[model samples]
Target: MATNILVTGASGFVGKNLSTFLQNKECKTNALSLRNENWKADFLKSVDAIIHLAGKAHDISNVSDSDEYYKINRDLTIELFNGFLNSDIKKFFYFSSVKAVADSVEGILTEDEVANPVTHYGKSKIEAERYILSQNLPEGKKVYIIRPCMIHGPGNKGNLNLLYKIVEKGLPWPLASFHNQRSFLGIDNLNYLIYEMLIKNDLQSGVYNFADDKALSTNELISTVNKALGKKAKLWKVSKGLIEKTAGLGDKLKLPLNSERLKKLTESYVVSNQKIKSALGIEKLPLSAEEGLIKTIKSFKKEK
Candidate 1:
């Protein structure tokens, strides 16, 4: 018997990949897009589990209305979970962002750390998480809230695309000398973790941070991109001071690479995946840092 899986945000990067992957694994998958009318009623059918991935993404430019984030993200979560309270589903998966826990973190990020999200996007997710945790689940019901760092895969359009653009242009890579360790979640790793979450009934019901097995640096990431492109990596040895100054100038000049992006380019933030690994009783997660990165870069090259 095929397990019935219902997924929201079916058209998104992670949701689209997850729905396709579930179907490929012989699960009866039904996807719901946010644009569809009366989606909740359409979603209340014979679903064995529900994966909630719909929400307003972090509007980096801060142009969206204040109420929009809460209404769509926080309010929608409350509405959906309330609906689930009446449904027959036994398992629920919510895709939250690491940003929900912290906008800027020091040292290795852990699940035990106190959450203090700085942006509207993160705050809204945190609100949703609190709502779900406050409710008592019916017997045999399990809920897993996943907070993953910057996720990148074959079709991702986030920060990964920026790197691809810089590398794809065959321009002299200006960030070669920059070094910073950051955690990333590959689409494959996320799929595998969700599968484990469904299978491991004994796993605790709480927030779980998902990420790749290894922490990788930005310079290292560029190397992988370069390898995939089959070109000699052109890393410039620009001094950090000069780069910072240039970025400062960019702040006023409205240049493409500004001070904020430079911080993202050279910041040390590593998310620990030990919790999920222990919960799944797995020795190692499937995708290594380099392998997943190279695959993502190669995918972009093929897309061009």
Candidate 2:
């Protein structure tokens, strides 16, 4: 039987892919926007599940206001969730980032860790998560708060795009000395998890962390991109002090290799997907981290 699904942020990278995937699975899908005034009356009664993906993303430029993050991410979510509670919706899937838990992960981040978001964007998401968890969900109603780390795929151009451009330009990776590992969620695997949550009757209402099974280093990521592009990798192991000084200068010159960018490039943010995998009764995701990244790199080449 085809399930009727309402997806917010349907035009976004994740939502666009998710909506298409749902339609391919023979599920009827509709998009709802927060800009509409009568969303509650219009969508609440019509869908079997609501996938809320619309929120103020973490702005890399740091230009967006703090209040704006709270208003859109936290306040809007509360309003929509309250409406969902009052309606006949069976499931609600909230797309929260792992940043909501920690700006920097010490080891493998799990659902059990105490959330201490650093940035305003992260704080706003945690606020929304708190609100959702605080609510007394009625019987037969399921709500999930998903925290995904560094989602990548064909249509999405995030930090991966910057890396892709650098690799395409044949620029030598200068920060090869910063040894670190980071987790990334492939859009295919993320789509698979969301679909599972939609169809599975056993997924309990709780927070789940989503990620690819394996964590990769920045060096490995560059190598993967090189392989995808059929180009030889050019990694330059510049001294840490020299790189730091250059990044300091770059910060003033508004260059790409700033302090923040360097941290993101080299930081080890290994998220644990064990809980979600166990809940879904799967040991591995459909796509590996490198495979998904390769697909994304291929898309970048196609664009050029």
Candidate 3:
């Protein structure tokens, strides 16, 4: 019999992709929205797995109410996990962000790192994780908390989209001089890992971080985008000192590049995926970091 899967945030980019992938694998899938009134009902009793992808992301604009993150990311998650515990579901998957572990990673982030979330969004996610860990599960029940860094693909929107616009316009990238290594997870690889987790019954239940095998610098990313667009890479070697000053002034002058934005652009955030790879018994992800990124860039170009 095909496995029955219940997915929250089914309308999201990840959810849409995952649901389609699951269906293609001959699994029965259902998408539940946050507004669904029957979320806690016995409707989930028959589900083989529940994948929770619904949550309020960190408001990059810094305009959303702080309470919103906790209510959805923490409160709703606890309620759903409780339902899972009560139901017959054998596996529960929660999509957490690396930001929940650390807003900044000094070195390669491991599963052993002490979580010190800096933002309310991160705090909320960690809160949900703690609740799940605190509960006792039946012998056969398993829970997987996945922390992915900067997930990007054709339909997703994030920092990658911003970079794509710059490269698409043939504009010179200014912060290429920062030379920082950052980890990214491709949608394709993430989809494959989740599918494996669902099918592989012997895997341990715990927190796992996911990322591409190799970390890429901003310079390399710009080059990749340029390559996808069939344009010469134009990276200006701007002074870090001047960039910092300009960003500082942007804090009060209502400029586009603020201190926070600059930090995100230049900061090094390399995450290690060794733990997840080891668990999945895989040596490499399905797609190279470069190949997945180029695929996303080409989609953006096609959208133009």
Candidate 4:
């Protein structure tokens, strides 16, 4: 029998990429939007597994309503997870974020962390995680709440696109000297990990951190983008202090390049993949820091 896998947040970045990816694996997949309120419980009844990708993301501008944090991220997850628990599903995969663990960790992020999130978005996700872990799920049930870093892929229009626009315009990549090593979740790697979970039922059920085997500096990322576009890589050595001061003014003026975004652009966030890679029994997926990024940046050239 073909395994039925139901995915939520079908219209979003990861889902759109994963749908096309699974077809290459010959997996039977069905997708539904979270905004689809009329969707019935029967719609999920026969599915072998559920990958819940729907949630409210962190708003960097801090413009979201105070109450809305719980409404979508926390409340909707419990509602969906309860439905899955009661149904015939054996495996449930929920896409959580590393921010739920901490805004910044001392070293690579681990599942054992106490989970101290600084924002309402992270707080809501942590609440959902608490609810899911608290349940005494059935003996055969397996739940995986995966926390992934920034996911990038083709057709993705995000902060990456914004960066691409800056570089493409020959802006001389101003943050060349600002060294940072942030983890990136390639769509291929994330999809492959979830596929392994669907196939390997005997694997332990718990929270997992998903990311590329290697972490890349923001400067390395710019070089990759430049290579993909076949353009000259021109990066300027502007002082980090000056950048931060300018960022502060930008924040006050509501300019495009602000202090918080500057921090995000230059923060070092490295996630360890030891636990997950060992569980899956795979060396690594085919995505490299440069290779995956090249494809993503190449998409912008055609658009321009």
- Deviation in angstroms for 242 in model 1? 1.5
Question: Sorted on TM-score, highest at the top, how do the candidates line up?
Answer: 3, 2, 1, 4
Higher lDDT: candidate 1 or 3? 3
Q: Write the per-residue lDDT of candidate 3 for residues 55-101, one digit (tens) a residue.
A: 99889778999999999999999998988887778999999899999
Pull out the clashing pairs in model 1.
none
TM-score of each prediction: 0.94, 0.96, 0.96, 0.93
In model 3, pairs of residues that clash are: none
How many residue pairs in model 4 have overlapping backbones? 0
Q: What TM-score should be assigned to candidate 2?
A: 0.96
Q: Which candidate is the best by lDDT?
A: 2
How much lDDT does candidate 4 score? 0.84
Candidate 2 runs further than 4 Å off: 44-46, 251-255
Candidate 4: which stretches are off by over 4 Å? 249-256
Q: Give Cα-based local distance difference scores for all models.
A: 0.84, 0.91, 0.89, 0.84
- Candidate 1 error regions (>4 Å): 43-45
What is the model-wide C-alpha lDDT for candidate 2?
A: 0.91
List where candidate 3 sits over 4 angstroms from the true fold.
none
Per-residue lDDT, model 1, residue 158, is 74
